[model samples]
Target: MNSKKLKILLSLFTLNSLSLYLYFSSHPDHRRLPSRSYSVSEYSPPHHPLSVKPWPILPSYLPWSQNSEPPFRSCEAYFGNGFTRRVDPLKPNAESHRKISPSAGGGGWFRCFYSETLRSSICEGGRIRMVPERIEMSRGGEKLESVIGREEDDELPNFRDGAFEIEVGDRSRVGKKLVDEEFLDKYLEEGTIDRHTMRGLIGSIRSVDATEFVCSEWIEEPTLLVTRFEYANLFHTVTDWYSTYVASRVTGLPIRPHVVFVDGHCQTPLEETWTALFSSLTYAKNFSSPVCFRHAILVPLGYETPLFKGLSETIDCYGASAQELWQKPDNKKTARLSEFGEMIRAAFGFPVDRHHIPKPASGHNILFVRREDYLAHPRHGGKVQTRLSNEPEVFDSIKSWASNHPNCKLNVVNGLFAHMPMKEQIRAIQDAAVIVGAHGAGLTHIVSATPKTVILEIISIEYRRPHFELIARWKGLEYHAIHLRGSYADPPVVIDKLSAILRNLGC
Candidate 1:
């Protein structure tokens, strides 16, 4: 009786336990419990400030403005001379924010602002200058407010340390050796310059990041970095100068640069005059008065060479010769080129007035740039084998065509202007409506020409280069090209084509 009773009770208990387990596994409410618990963690939004102070609208000259949707708020957050990493509220998670170097190379005033709706932030990428007893920001010739009350931890390194500056020797004959001897001799004597040698020259001294120049020299003010690398040849000097502009674009900082020179003749009359017009030329060895920069940027050389890995095109470019560095081309982008021109006109001790160009009394000046007596290469002088020939006929035909139009003003400017002061050169080209010239470095003066000007480039078929063509396109000028055939000294230009070009320009 005891065995039968125990077996029946055990079997009944086991059956009930199995039935309960099966019911819970298939039940809809019981199945959803696990997923609901997981969703609580995944779908919960991170906490962020619902409201922010209205973002102050920056002036146009200040580089940026509040162009997004409303609820835009920005505040000035202070950082130590060398601060990196995102500020508070910009990104709730400190790790997710971008690593920013406020004192790019040295220490100065820095600002960070954000748009809550856009979930993005913008900061001063360059050095900011402060007035005595006042917190002010100086940029693009305008003064801005440096509001306080929001300060972040200064996570920057000791900017005064020599870690940023790269020195070879006191005089560092690298510049001289490259420009005067090795660069020229190797290219001229050897007929073909080595690529590694050229790349070494670019990376050796001249190519440094803008942040590398930030130091205690400037103390606590903003600095503009001016580089004096290759300023002899007009093409090399101007193209090199494009790096400074590119640095500013990359860092959002003003370019207050210190010019380092290897050659006594580092800059030509035009180069010197061009720089003097906006920023002063200075030597890096002037330690007693070392150029101080709060916000500094280095324009990496963008070339078709290996020393700089980026391509010449603006799009599809990145990486640098050095780590943590960015690279961009010195070629023309319309807005940047126009800004460069305006800054140049302002620097030359002239009023920044665009109206200085006199209205056309009759018609625009058809300034014909003749290369009759001009020579680029040292061996170019005694050559009957030059690329441009029949210069006299080209000038004569343009003059003859101009006579037919009452508004057409014809001026034949020979190479004599090369000897003129840079100011005179700027003045001569500044008022020109139509710049007609042979393909040469003299055409670089088009940087001073007003917008909507016409540029007619007479290129020799033997030596065809798109340098000036790119310049004209960037400067927003009307460009027309005429090819020549025959000898360099007397290549023939199509007179009828020249006449048609003049007619289209309302000559």
Candidate 2:
């Protein structure tokens, strides 16, 4: 009787086991065990849902920190290999300290410290000393110039006919000693000073004694030290902003650092734009007494740093060459320039990564950047030289063409950047499918354009330059040009070029 009962139970158990296996295999979602209490010895944590997530995580790729930011490690780890160069405190002026050793991915040289305190001592005419550290005055109270033995080259050379001639003669000896013909040619054409000149401007690094200067106010957050030009031209400002971004990336700050403009220049119209990119923005002049930063990064000038070069040049800033600074090593498909463009768009709170997305049925946006008379600064009257003799006529013709185009619907945008707020201007540029403009600073907005955007720059014979052309190439955007015989571009010729570009883009 016991043998027969055991046999029946064994057969039932085998059949039940087979049926459960089949059910679980077919309904895999139900395979997970139901919630239940377990003994301490038997308990095992479930795997994280995100553990099997796919590649190319968006938030991880962002240069700036987000919620649950990564922990702050050593400067070497944060800045990547070979990006941070330690300055020998004893021999700060040694030859090795003059240049940062090169590394892959080409991020510009930067010095980061867990804590750094700088004293801003006011000089004559309310200009704060621009040196990295405070200088010890001789017992006789000698001026900085007498102590350093060379006058600072803080002022950019004016390239006007008379000023240019005077500058060449004035710097003739320096040019002969520190630079070659090609360097001098670039200096003359682009107003770019060499490394030696930049070094001279910054002066020698003196003793860093926090006790020497009193701190009236202290900035507790991480801060970045940036030197900028006095004027607010869009091109120069872009270089400064880009350099700041590179500094943020290389330093590996978990959060965006507060930016301190170390220059003595008064506030300009563009200062508002600078304020938006960081946690805070302050000028050297703003500190009535010496202010100290808890954690500081002294960012080198983009002009002198190899990570990006040719800052003063009318052509694109050496951004295209500094792929290491912008492009993540793992992602080779997106251009480094485009990464920077995305950074700027994100900083300005504009929609990002929308360049390659399919367009709506209505059609593409053709943005025509218009240059008009406006007061850029206090010194000059509100009068801009006419680059396009008949700009209004050309704009009208383009508008007409966009409306009549049969291939696809076209939306022509009159990009009157001067009248628009900075955010609105960026929005217009980022949203455009094509940007058209005469040779002007307003055209610099193309740096923030979407990847798929096309650029059509009209160069008058009088103002021929490669600024926008080089930018388009670096950004991997399609670019075209219309060469005008004079300051005037024929409307029909521009329309033809626009039509051809749209045709190629399958408009």
Candidate 3:
């Protein structure tokens, strides 16, 4: 029966082929028509299985299933200390991001799916634990030139070692400085880098890449990086410190700049916590993005500074200092961190979340704050006092030359100090030949000063904040002591100390 059916089909095919060939031959004039070769196209289409599998539609009855998509997103559930559902990163699912365990410095169970420009944070799961019981002790006896070589430029003697200057096994073993200080639980003590130190360090660097490239394996440096960056944090945000830097290209300053907080600060916008978070002194290190810019960091924790240099922006008027009169006493009372972040953003003309990493340029000055410095100068003394009261006296205690020294020149233009950008304030302070200040937030700005900058650390003759002296020495600054008779609130804090320090610098 099969052979008979095959013979019938063959007979039919033969008749059809003969008829078609005859018809084509009869129409030979069609050769003038374009060659009718079928233009072949190849593609992949969804494959349907010949057989069906059992359906678990019963899951639809789940209480959470009411809003589940028809074709639910695929998640790979990998259970470890906790369940980590690896959502497809390409789809922007919350589960696809990197998981940051409290062990790795997360507040609780927060996960940052991507490793972006992590310029700010030092250690994650930041608890104010006793300082590390052990650290590769600094071979303090070895001079800077002896350890890393004195010649920082090209043509160094140890060029053959490798691109990195640190010699093999050079991290001479040293005992970690045991942490002896204690603080209340209210301070976000878990994270590293005291806010005071960070302010100085962050203020020291003059520019943050509005954009930066995200990197995971570039472990020798920031979690993210871009050429010529300043004041970048984990949120992939930047602060252009030099007034000339942003305006060197664009004519004016920006009203809104892209930003992110890399430190272990809680990520919350002022709008989200208008009543609760802001009302209470939660922590100085919190972060948030309101408007003008959304974050590409995708999540709050994923946001970092020094973003990839794939984008660009006109620095324009955004580089100028804010004219909202924040230095005034009443203004200081309203100076919220979110607002501070907002003021600089607008001054630099960048969306709080919009960053374009710029292509690197030559002859750029680079400023780096050692990890040692970052851990010392916290804004709050592990107390809820990080938020300072804006008062004339508070400003008076700092006794900064910002108002007195209208025209100072460190590099190029004169009168630079008078019109510097928010980021430039630290740089200008650093450029000063002599530095002076009582024990307060303004001292944090001193970390940016050029080496050889003399420091006049004013503290009580009876009481002392030892970190200042240690930091001054570690940073290679010329250290001087000013022993005051009382707390920093006293008049001698400024009147007696400021003038002497300034005269020494030839101010």
Candidate whose lDDT is highest: 2
TM-score of each model, paired residue for residue: 0.50, 0.61, 0.25
Residues 59-106 of candidate 2 have per-residue lDDT tens digits of 113333222222223221222222322221121122222322211011
Query: All models: lDDT?
Result: 0.39, 0.51, 0.25
- The sequence of per-residue lDDT tens digits that candidate 1 reaches over residues 142-169 is 1112212211111111122121222112
Better of 2 and 3 by lDDT: 2
Clashes per prediction? Answer: 29, 1, 71
- Per residue, candidate 3 scores C-alpha lDDT tens digits across 136-210 of 112121222333322211111111111111101111211211111231111112233222222222112111111
Q: Give per-residue lDDT, candidate 2, residue 312.
A: 33
Give the C-alpha miss distance for residue 322 in model 1, angstroms: 34
**What TM-score does prediction 2 earn?**
0.61
lDDT of 3: 0.25
Which run of 10 residues does model 3 get worst, by summed lDDT? 73-82
How does candidate 3 fare on TM-score?
0.25
